[model samples]
Target: MPWPVAAHRSRLLLRGRILLDLRHPGAAIEELREACGILDVEEAADAVRGPALLDLARALRESGAEDGETRRALLRAQRAAGDDPELLLPCLAALAAFHDAAGEAGEADETYERAVLLAPADGALRCQLLTAWGESLLRRASTRDGAGIVDRAEYVLREALKSLPARSAQRGRLQGLVGSALAQRFRHLGFLPDLFESRHLLGQAVRAAADAAVRAEVWLQLGRVRLEGWHHAGAPVLMDALQAYESAEREAQAAHGSDPGSVTAARARHGSGAVLALMGRPGAARSAYTAAREQWQRLVGALREVDWADVELTRRVESEPATGEGRTRAERELRDREEGDWERVAPPWWPWTGEWSNWSEFDRS
Candidate 1:
């Protein structure tokens, strides 16, 4: 950790961080590799090496590099961190996130547990780790064994929220995660209380959200909560749900570029279609579903030219094309509509019911 060498490595790391923030992962990866290379042969550069290696791993992952390299770099960072909690905790968090994204639930849980245990109880790092851990659990909350996981996720995110200030930058995001977890719990347990609480929290998240993308997602979740509440509680929440979906659509359109914006917009349209179907508006529902389908097709067409970095999107496009059986079904539905067969467009076998699962891919925060 010589002063001159440390300063140089610090400059490189800072530049790499800025590049990564700007979405220039390729350039970030190069700068971070150079930073990590600075202390490669130095026996006492462990302090510098840990953070540099972690940044390198992040940049590599963002650049779509091979998973092996990313994992190796993370492991090296942990080793270099030695007994330093400041460095080790971040390494653990990143490693946990990597495991979570790879669907290794067991390993992710273990790593997150270790990080939580090591992080100071009231520290910002603890909140950050819990947020990531909760989000990971939330992502898996739709699986068969989702009941317990979603409940745990709710508790974790709530605890994280307790450590955050009311108007903190991360508060809205934490609230949204908690709301999502509760919403998933309601979906699993059929509890009206959970749905109500989820709607409340998501509303707060929407109001507090600083980023348009975050607001869009919160609004979308709120719409789902409202729709479910309307169905079960028999309240006048249908219009409310439609409003939320429309809000989400606008926010997503304004917040993102072509690729991700199209995906979010499609989800919002599908959500609107669901609400319209529930409102007994068959024609409107059909139109909304058609718009959603078209948007998804457009997204697939755009991504077909490039390698899809999102595995879920790739899976959907490959397995659930709008052509073939899907197109045939659409044509039959259209003919039914043309023949004034509104009854056939009702629930249980409608387009939204049949294809909602495929169209419901959500973005991670």
Candidate 2:
């Protein structure tokens, strides 16, 4: 209501923060802007300006506004926070997520790497960054990519897990993400070890997850990995994979029987069809596949928008041959997305212009 000045700075700041948390970024921006306006940075403590500016940047970013003003606000927040790890950690994470949500994977990875380095002992944050980085790498994968990315992603996820305390919530999440990544890697390179490891990790994730939906998804992933393994190797593996898919189907049914057209639900149904087909049950598999196809059509019919950003019209996937990476393929892809056209949006630090992309150059004291 009343303008925020010295006496009411803290209260205004708190209100802005609450609004941001409640996803009312537009309202938060108003309070934050006026509050910050009332106090001069040179006169205000770093604690005050740093956090307030960071929140303002967050407000800006969350409101679907990733303009230069928002970028400058984050940079100012960083400068105000200086070398305070407490302030810097969150600022970096916000910046990284901003990049990630904007589809700027390279920038997100770079920012996350800096955050990881900034807090070497903070396993939780390190695990978070590593997990995000690994995910980005996998998403950047193409048919032209090599197995090294899968290898690197698996390694990174393993390392990410080590950062969390045993059996912690964060640890469980990383385990699930790692499992998903491993499954992807196995699919790419046809590596037995990757499939086995993926199965193990997904098992842990399934056990740890209390939510039926989450566990269902993990079961589906594990089932797919096992099914692929069965395709390449036979006998006991085939049976194991069939069981996994069946388990996934059961979980999916339990989780979302009311929502037959949901992504996970359709995936489960499709996966079950794959299992049926693999087992040479043509009649049953045909029925299952038909059902799955109907579910997919339902999904397409349900799209609220003519062009939903969430749906990819065409998915471009380039994968290496079983033999190895090809010269032309290697040139086009990153060893799991380490390299690409992303350079256009990633030429330099958008915030600092030219003052080093990372926080290493900052003075601690």
Candidate 3:
């Protein structure tokens, strides 16, 4: 006999409850696998199953499952569920985020563009999508297009903030994201004025963040802005920026735990190392670079291994040149070579007056 309607509904609801309880990331992924197994066994064409399946796919994506599997599951569920636009939006957003994580910039951009089109009135989602879109553009821009992307980023961020309620908790996070975007814009333009604004906004974000990890990110960005403008400061300012980055790193590490897959901690280490290198402290800079490099290398390796297929993300971590020591050696060699040549031809250019023979000897002295 066909299953009773109420009994089928109860079974589906029970399965959903089981999935919801699978909250730990690892367990959630396993639950998704189990859900797939259950669906396969049922093999029944029931419209009611679509929403539950979509939820399962979303849970899998958020839990850090491979993108291909998540996309396939979401697409199947979405199609079976009659492609409801509202239902599709979350899956689209999740897919876009997955592609972004995987470094598939073109795919991510396209997905987010479609998502924004679907939800035109969602100011916050639009802003987040636009910021991400602008980031991809900035990465790929030749010198000609980078500035325009930055401008778009700034406009979108402002618009998003304008749409938000004044007391929204998301305001702080949005401000931090905008500040980071502005700092990138300034860095590309080599303009100091924008950086001042960036620093101010980042300071506000730092004060407003309730989460330790988010606060660390704000402080790290602030340190980066200060370090970039370090030429304006003496040793004291440089030291202060270094301290800020170091503190940020510690806090991020504490909040995320060691090996936390934390982009913030990795970035903080890199920023700290760069500032140390600029301050002429090679040993400390090398140590920081080593940590940053390790994190970046792991991420890159993960990407290369065809893991994290849902999102396409790329990161470039730079370290102080190992050839820095060689610079001193090269300089000494050049000076010795010049001295040898001079010794051989000293007569006419005696006392180093050859290049300035027209000047009076007293003036030369």
Candidate 4:
């Protein structure tokens, strides 16, 4: 059999294996590597098959192959394909994903921009690429421009929304991505508009998502938005959010047969605890917080045994909160300050604003 034909056959077989054996991570990784190797051989046969080579590069990256191998594969394909726009977009998108994973934010940003330019009319593609770019910006915001990057992310998401076909499956996914982007922006800017937008979009996502895991994630985001930013209103919103996270967690465990990091269970527990505390349920809050703190501590302890050179692991480590009494004190103080600030500056129509003081007093009575 000719090498090119064999490689094409191998690619097809590997893709089938990937779709059929999603439960086996090891099998998926093996199939991805097989696909990558076949594509490399095909590239040697005909250097101009840019799209095929780019697909191989993306497969390798997704399989957690070595960064150098993935980069070399992509660069060779890009050089072979030259300036073909059809070839460049996937190449750029794959490179963006690789660079972002490798912590090369600047390179990721450049590649993502190129990818967006290549496929400006494809909303779903643009949304996926911009989400990658936005995440990279969020990661390195302190060193190279902050709010501006967030603003750009907001604009990109809005533009992506304009391209979405209403009531379509693609639009549903795009809505979740947009909502997530808006939530991140709110975290950065503390703007009520962003929060409101995020809430609205996330609500849409929850309604549109058919998958339990996806719906759960949308619910988790909505919960975090309310609990963290909306002054802990003691409304039913927090409970609703908790239910969503719990549902997601349960579904993830059943499907994956383990905690698959689906909903960030520890964070959910802590947030639920915080909400409970604010609602004058100290005992339950304490239990929930203790569970979260233990989980976080165990994660930190596990990390301490691993090599810090693992950039992805290092990133996870950086995200873990310090535990014990110190964390409790800090969390309480931060929430108090935020609540006080909101009380002073909240819009008149906002439920927590003092303009509703008489109503609130009556309700308390």
The prediction achieving the highest lDDT against the true structure is 1
Q: Against the true structure, what is each candidate's TM-score?
A: 0.76, 0.72, 0.61, 0.64
Cα lDDT of model 2 by residue, 1-365, tens digit: 34444558777777988887687999889888877876564367877787777778777876767578788887787787788988887678667766765678778878877887886676555666676666555555422353556676667767777777776755555677678777766656766887778778888888887666666667766776666554445423545755665676676677667343355555555556545444445355456556655665666786622222212211110011121124343332222124323221111110100011122112122
Model 4, 144: alpha-carbon shift in Å? Answer: 13
Predicted candidate 1 versus true structure: per-residue lDDT over 78-148, tens digit per residue:
89888888778778888887787677999998998899999898776777777777777777775556777
lDDT of each model, Cα atoms only?
0.70, 0.60, 0.57, 0.54
lDDT winner, 2 or 3:
2
Whole-model lDDT, model 1: 0.70
TM-score of 1: 0.76
Q: Model 3: per-residue lDDT, tens digit, 1-365?
A: 24664455456555554655555545555544555555556774535455556556656665777778767876776576455666665556655665666778778778877876775575555555554554444344323345656666666666666666678776666677667667777756867777888778877887777777777767776786766555433223667778778877887877777553455666667667656555545577668767866765665655532223111221222332432343453353243334452122111100000011110110100
- For model 3 the local lDDT of residue 348 reads 11
- Lowest lDDT 10-mer window, candidate 2? 345-354
| Of 2 and 4, the candidate ranking higher by lDDT | 2
**Residue 108 in candidate 2 has what lDDT?**
80
Tell how far residue 153 is off in model 1, in angstroms. Answer: 0.6
Q: Taking the tens digit of each residue's C-alpha lDDT, what string does model 4 give over 237-354?
A: 4456556545544544443333223224444455555555544445666676666555555555555332222223223323434223334644644554455633321111100000
